[model samples]
Target: MVRAAARLPLFFLAASLVAGFLLRAPRSQRVDSEAARQSPRARTAVAATGELVKSLRIGGTIGTLRSAAIRAPELRGSHVVGWAVLTLVRLADAGSSVEAGDVVAEFELKRLEDHIADLQSYVTQAQASLRKRRSEIRILQGAWQHEALRARAESAKAVLGLPTAEVLSAIEAEILRMAAAVARARGKRQAEVERLRALVIAADLGYFDVWIRKELLHIERHSRDYKRLRMKTPIGGMVIRETIFNRSGEYAQVKAGDRINSGALFMRIADTSQMVVRAMVNQVDARTIRVGNRAVVQLDAYPGLRFSGHVAEMAALASPRRGTRSAGRMFIRQIPVRILIEDKDKRVLPGLSASVDVIVSMGQRGVLIPREALQHETGQQAGTFVRVAEGGEYRKRHIAVQGLSDTEALIRSGLAPGEQVLLKGLPRDQRR
Candidate 1:
């Protein structure tokens, strides 16, 4: 009787556990079905009919349309001059506003000034020496004239004695003839000496004159260099520091106390009134882009800023894409394009990252949607599809694309205005 009662309780417990599991299974499945119907896994967008504008977006760097580059002054004075490297003493701070004819940079003029002073001293000394040489030549010429006059007088006296000898004895006549011949010869010798001395004096004067002129030229050249050492900006604009190789041979922004090579550009002054964006477009799109095409420029740094612009120029030839490799035999070619920004703003600075939206096609009425919403059907069903939202589920439908821009796609068929479409596609169960 005790065993029978224990068995009865065990059987009753087993029956209750089986009934509880059977009751809960249907409820759990019902809750899951309700949740799936209420919540959406993919975000949806409404299809719209509007003017579809197609634009080609290209990235570029901002630059001034008119700018002047400041370079280290070249040593133009003399070939064998001092200061092989130009040491910057004072430089205009970057981003500082400057006016025309403003001093943008100043070098250590100590060496240059000293060099100019030494050259001037040399020039002064040379001028004095030249003057002394002229005086000496004049004095030598006077001495030559006096000696010639004395020789002529001696010859005349000897000739007169020869006539006296003719009236005397034969021996006296012979002695007079010899004295006349000797005097004539002495005069001729003196004339020859004077002629040679005159030529020598003329040569010496010419040499001294050339030397003086050379020294004067050196002085002038050094003076010009001295003026160049004080660098000045030719136009009014903001100063921009340039990256250059420092004394340690590392690339860095140009600053005071840096030594730069002659003629190396160290800074630039940009004309903020007019700006430009230098961009590169693929060769495939190059044919469609033309000069004077309207464009809108947006800066990456300042997302809210937009500037109006137009295509100013395009490169004639295409260049090979740098830092990229070709998939096979064909390499990518990029065509350079320059866009001139028409809008003037203080924030439009050089070297800013910007994007240009070159309007290729004007607005045309068509059904448009976000390009990401369009999906491609694979396998046996091969076509473009977009998932439409209906009753908490997605329906895949074929759509015909008329045109695709950088951001939006123009739909030609299989989609209507005001229909909600999923931006992302769901699984097979969620998408009918």
Candidate 2:
């Protein structure tokens, strides 16, 4: 039994040693297999000969080709009461069509009425004064005529050598002078009457001479205001905006009694018949943007839809935003580029945000490779690697990269088409 027990201990120790060896051997084999699978193999550098060179892209937005703003008219009188919008018969809605000489709006005539009344009063006073003047002139004329007639009779007697012939001659001369005076008085009276009549007639017709002159002067002063406030579409197009006062028994924020300031923004209008994409480029990129440069516009609201356009113009000057500084002292230059679209729909609205892509250049056919292939060494050398068939190794090859994009680079030279290049990390054994 003692010998069997000692033998059993040795056998058990041998079995444990074998099992440990078997477990360790499989683990070592597994490690080797995994390493082999992870290692990179030799790959033939193939050339990608396809359309690689494409147009350079720039950004822009969709906008209206034409736009307008409506403003208030310049009216006089601080105490001038509220305004009454009198739409002329021919006036149309913002998007509606209109003909020339259409009345857009008219002011209330209360002030004008008061002016007419005051003028009438002045006319009445003028007529009364004129009548008094005429009566005085007539009385003077009558007295002068009587004296002259008596003197004329005396003169006739004198001429015939009657009694007091010298006195009579003097009296007859006085009568002739008195007759001339009466004629002058009559002429003055007639002029006064005519002037009064003119004043009265003008007042009766609601047309005061001075007031008419003033009205003309007012028209001259507000001509520009009228033109602006009329809010006519400079070109024939669809009205994209309109301001309609609601008359649903709700009092307006500004009413007939409320005062409005001159130059207020009363309304706005835009022409939507044609649309454009307006893009603002940075000062650095603004120089590259020119009229007639082709572009692509994308709306965030409408994804996957791209509209094509061209740069119509660039602004002459740069205008910065208020109270804000630009980055890198690079003021936001004014690059007013208009991108025209052939199709205009309701989807395009004024002030809708949009993105624009301007084509700077196009590379139709060129050699391109993934950007990851490029590697920069400590010596500041940029190059890529190509795998060699021999012993699964890679050769460090230098290539000239012309243009680089987000995902690829344009290979100018030092590489041929259908050439195989290494991707990802190098083989673990080869990595230093």
Candidate 3:
């Protein structure tokens, strides 16, 4: 009887444990059900009828639409034959703001200036030498004139003596006649010598004239080169130094004391006031883009920032897309499109990666919601759907999508304005 009583108490304890477990199971499930109902499975949005704008998104770089490339000025004028390796003496500070006519770069003008000064001195010396030669020739001509006049006088005197020979002896007359003939001969020889000397002097003067003129032309040419050596910006903006092959055969930014070839891409002055995104569109989608279409530009650097823009221009011809291509897809081409950003912001700079959404179509009235709100069915039911909110619960509703955009979708049927839809995707049982 004692064993039975102990066994009975043990059985009662076991029974009590079983009964509590069964009773607590239902209460735990009810609590879980209440919590699930309290928390929302997906975000909800009310559908509204409004203008739907469809946009085509494209990736590109942000750059100044009116920016000008500052290239190394071509060396021109006399004595500069072939390509001249220009030595940079001074360069404008990189990223410095500048205006039109501001001096951006200067070559090693010391050498050119010294050369010009030397030429000037040479020109001065040549002028002096030419004047000295001219004066010497004049003096020689005067001496020749004096000598000719003396010869003529001597000849005249000899002739007068011959006329007096009539009252003198025959030997004296013969002597006077011979003396006059010799004097006449000497005069004739002197005249010929003076004429030849004058011709030679004129030739010497001509040589000096030619040499001086040539030197003057050379000086003019070098002077012009001097001016060109000082590079100036044609348009005002920020100066951006370009990469160059330095003396060490490595590419580096152009700086003072670097030697650059003429006509090389030296630098650029980008107009930050007006920026544009040079984006590319696949050739197939290029037909839908048109000029004057409104666009929204967003820079990758600043995720929250957006700039209003418009389609400024489109390239008529397509070119091979830049960057790497996948295998067997080497023939893909893209059309270049330039979008002009109307909003001014300091952060808009060149070479920034940007996303441009060009609004190709707009002003269509329809019931619109985010494209994420629409769900696609599979297998047996193949159509678009949305989880519509009805009173306190949600139900799946069929919807007809008329058009789709980068962010929103236009609903044509099976959905109406003032209806709420779920944006997040939920399980079938949970959605109900």
Error of 1 at 132 (Å): 3.6
**TM-score of model 2 relative to the true fold?**
0.48
Q: In model 2, how large is the Cα lDDT of residue 161?
A: 50
Best lDDT among the predictions, by candidate number: 1
Tens digits of per-residue lDDT for model 1, 121-198: 877887788789888878878887998999999999999887688589998899889989999999999989988987
Q: Candidate 2: where are CA atoms >4 Å away?
A: 1-61, 76-260, 321-323, 326-334, 366-432
- What is the full ranking by TM-score, best candidate first? 1, 3, 2
Poorest 10 consecutive residues by lDDT, candidate 2: 82-91
How many clashing residue pairs appear in each of the predictions shown? 0, 22, 0
| Candidate 2 whole-model C-alpha lDDT, 0 to 1 | 0.58
Instruction: Provide TM-scores for the models.
Output: 0.77, 0.48, 0.72
Clashes of 2: 22
Model 3 misplaced stretches (Cα beyond 4 Å): 1-48, 76-83, 150-193, 320-334, 387-397, 413-432
Give the alpha carbon lDDT tens digit for every residue of 97-192 in model 3.
Answer: 999999899887777778779888998999999999989988888888898899999988987787698898998888889999999898889889
